[model samples]
Target: MNPIRRRPHIDYELDAGGRRSLWQTLPTLTPGLGVLRHYERRWLRLDGFAGIAVVAYMVPQVMAYTAIVNVPPVVGLWTALAACVVYAIIGGSRVLSVGPESTVALMAGAAIAPLAGGDPERAIVLSSALCLVVAGWCLLARLFRLGIIADLLSQPLLVGYLAGGAVLMVVGQLGRVTGTDVEGETIVAQLRSFFSVVGDTHLPTLAVAAGTLTLLLAIVILRPRWPGPLIAVAAATIAAVVLDLPAYGVAETGPVPVGLPLPHLPIISWADLQTLLLAGLGVAVVAYSDNTLIGRAFKPKTEPGEKSVPDVDPQQELVAMSGVHVAAGLFGGFPMSSSGSRTALAIASGARTQVYSLVAAVCIIAVLFFAGPLLEPLPSAALGAVVIYAASKLVSIPDIKRLARFRTSELVLAIVACLGTVLIGILAGVGIAIALSILEMVQRLARPHEGVLGRVEGIAGMHDVDDYDQATTLPGLVVYRYDAPLFFINVGDLRRRALLAVEKENEGDPDHPVRWFILNAEANVEIDISATDGLKALHDDLSERGIRFGLARVKQDLRTPLERAGLVELIGEDMMFPTLPVMEKAYLTWAAEQAVREQTALEHQAVPGADEPAGTPPARPVDTNESDR
Candidate 1:
């Protein structure tokens, strides 16, 4: 060979035994490089503005959510920053920006207040512990692919639950915004405090709040993506700076540490773990739900206009967001939720990858590292204004309108979940969702749809005693179809109706004793012990009456249970068919054999005058054609 060169890496195949997948380990991608590569793309202008816009909106929200948790505003910034950075690495969603979410923050605050004794440092400690717990839970979830739990939370429940939570969040914040010292230990206590301070509202603060509300509404009705919160926050900061709002009982965003996240792995005692268990569980559910929704929402638009296509891997989202939570805790920060407002901003800004979040993270770091003193002067009122506006977005009118069209029970459940979120707590709201879903499912189970499988006339191998219209039936053979699982709840009705129908068909018909009855098992997924017992009893009773009971189109999964119950043995192999076509063939063969046997018996017994005449025509044939007569 003419100076053979070394084979390129492309030609080198690594041993299959030692290969690791990217997901199994991890991959590094940074926005700076990505942004540089696509500098001339339209995304550069739109997404760049969106990042800054989102950051502006986020600053106040972080402060507000932190406040709700009784932690300092800087902690919010710290947590949000770390979250952004961590998510940039691990998150699959191109636009999702992890940060302090209102619902989760409120939940964290409620959980930590008693344990931390209102100390910011101590609260951070507990939050860190909580974060670890959540991260552990999420990691466990990913390992087990437990993301299906989110699917069980119906849309109606989510809408209602969030609406309820929003109400609670707004009410919870009202006391702090007003000058009144409303007395309460937690949300319920805080609700009382908010109400008590109704008359003590500061006119100026109220005016600011009013103006903010108006701006947000105008934005909702017109430019939905307008930076109303950012503008409102800027205005609040200017007012606090120039108006000396603190002296007039306006709270201020106190000192925020401007440095690294101290790595203090929380050492909570077993006692502490016990106390936080319920709260931890609640946070796990709410955080998973809230984060997944946001993550999936911001997942890159793969199919044009196919917003419903959820491309974000739920397991990935959990891992990413939980990691962010852990990172935030390491850096002396409050608990965070997936930020919807910032996400919307990112989408509006033409962000192509998760780099915008990284940019946001850097910006937060810069603000904390070098621009600290500048932010220190920022007022609590401004942050409060930001919080109010961010929370307002949780209430979606279109969602409510959509909810209105659903079943009353589901709609009521949604409303209950929302109110529960508002008046009770986040956990209760989720519980209601679970309860309602199960209940609705149970309602269907209670009275399942059962139909007589009667084929129309002029149909080949036809049969039916039609419920929808007058139709012919096979003289003595009946087919019943149940469109639900065979279970204890509905088994009694099945036994009663099937037996009665068989008996009625035999009413003194000289030539016909109900010979065969077949149950359509196409939709039945399973039959439990109780159902099996009922079926055994039905088989015995029908056999005693000289009738054969069998099945048609029993799905594969149900075969094992039926076999284990000796149903197949009792029904005989020839009587069970995998498809309707085969079943029809089997039925026709059985009918012909029975007809021959009947004629043979009649001729054999013809010695006496008791023999019936051949004048009586044979029984009507079954027609199984799908079309109606």
Candidate 2:
């Protein structure tokens, strides 16, 4: 391993007089230039080897992904070649390999299939247009700095989505694998169709596919680090040519067109554009989500002493992906994204920088110009087998099992997302995953957790009364903690929980009836008019019941709203404290003072000269300087 070399830091602050910020300019212009400038010549040999390996791995995989998109294999090759060059220049990560990934291909195919109306040329045109639309979406997101949008698909949702996509990919390829006319709009329908035609499955195609699949799996299990797909594809191509499998009723990939794709805009109708816009947006979201997830996962590891991975600008990644998609669209190709498998392979094969992507592009160009005919004998079933192998790996069984063991609700969500993709459509499945994630968040916020706080013996800080058995509550004081922000949807619930805490405390010891309610507002980051009004009403209700309302750790921003809502006046300004300890001290002093005042009134009432009626106390004057004191 090379010793971690620290780059010298230069402070280049932007000034008001038209001075550009190096932070803004450098990331936009040459994202990969930093690594390239400090390029080590010794790493070139490894990059070169990795580049060749990527080419070998990418060609077959991209060609296989084309089947998912229902396009000519050459289009997939063009997509891989074009995206690689563009991403190498602008991408944030070094080893991330951009290409026609299966998920994006599946989404693009679904989006364009209706518009194309069974025409392969039209399909290509629509797919290219979709790529352009996706590029536009990426650019929009980057401009708005919506990089955090990728996190909408949480890990559990993503795991389920990919697992569902894996199932769809495998099922969709079954027709090619078995040479059966399995037809359906969805996975369930396709499975039904497949089962009905099971008797008519072509033995030759199934044999080739099964054999190829077995060989690839065996290579993966035995050698593990070898380019198993590439090796399997080559061996399958040789076997098909030598055995004349096409004559024996096995379908082959057909002759690949020789030459690079010419740069041209795909002509798309306005109506088709309108229809595809939503689908393109979905594709962009899923693609970037998957791309960034993979990018972050394999982020360049720092040396032993480093605290974090090198900075990965998500906006720069968006820009890089946009450039790749726009280039892919211009070059007669479909949409693309970062491939996790190829990226891992590149890193494992010793790739050092984006230069490896450039080398891979050059090698792919060579294949297009000279070796296109060599791939003609590759069997369709064998390609399907390769895709199946890749897709099978997408299902993270261990992750699913882990979720099941710990989080049952999230496990159900994962299963539902998986089932949604397999039973509905891939595009709908993504929608379902995103919707579920948002719904889960809203559900948590609506009924957020509440904790009753009490002081623990020998503990320095306050603790949850429910969590600690030995936690002691102050006489006549109920301290409550709301774990979520104060919002219109949850304010009512917060009020109910607060009252319930007081009621529960009183039930525990009716003799020391709860007289003060202190809210720990540390978790309440946001407040709205509805929540503010709710707080005022709660304070009034508590005051009528002879209970004082107090707020602790209230953020500075919330004070303005509380004043505007008259809550500050209702609860008294002195009732708000900056910390729990201060609040406790003030509450204890007030409780003791109230007790003294009551005892004094009682003694005065017992005297014959008392002016107040029996069982009635004279109104006390408000102390304006109490908080100041």
- Winning candidate number (TM-score): 2
lDDT by residue (tens digit), candidate 1, 337-398: 68776787777666766667767877787878886666665566555555676667678778
CA lDDT, every prediction?
Answer: 0.71, 0.86
| Backbone collisions counted per model | 16, 0
TM-score of each: 0.82, 0.92
Instruction: Name the Cα RMSD for model 1.
Output: 8.5
Off by over 4 Å in 2: 1-23, 301-309, 610-629
How do the residues 1-629 of candidate 2 rate in per-residue lDDT, one tens digit apiece?
Answer: 99999999989876423547888686555678767887879778878988998888888889988888888888888999998888888888888998889888888887787677667788889888998999999999987888887988987898899998898889889899999998777777889999999899999999999999999999989988887888898999999999999999999888889998679998888999998888988899999988888998885434488455376678788888788899999988998888888888888888878889989999999989998899999999998998898898888889999999989998999989998988888899889999999999988998998898999888898888888888898888888899998989999999888888888888889999887799999999889999998898888777777678889999988888888888888777788899999999998888778777777766765674477567665545333223233
At residue 585, give the lDDT of candidate 1. Answer: 67
Error of 1 at 565 (Å): 3.0
User: Cα deviation in Å at residue 465, candidate 1?
Assistant: 8.4
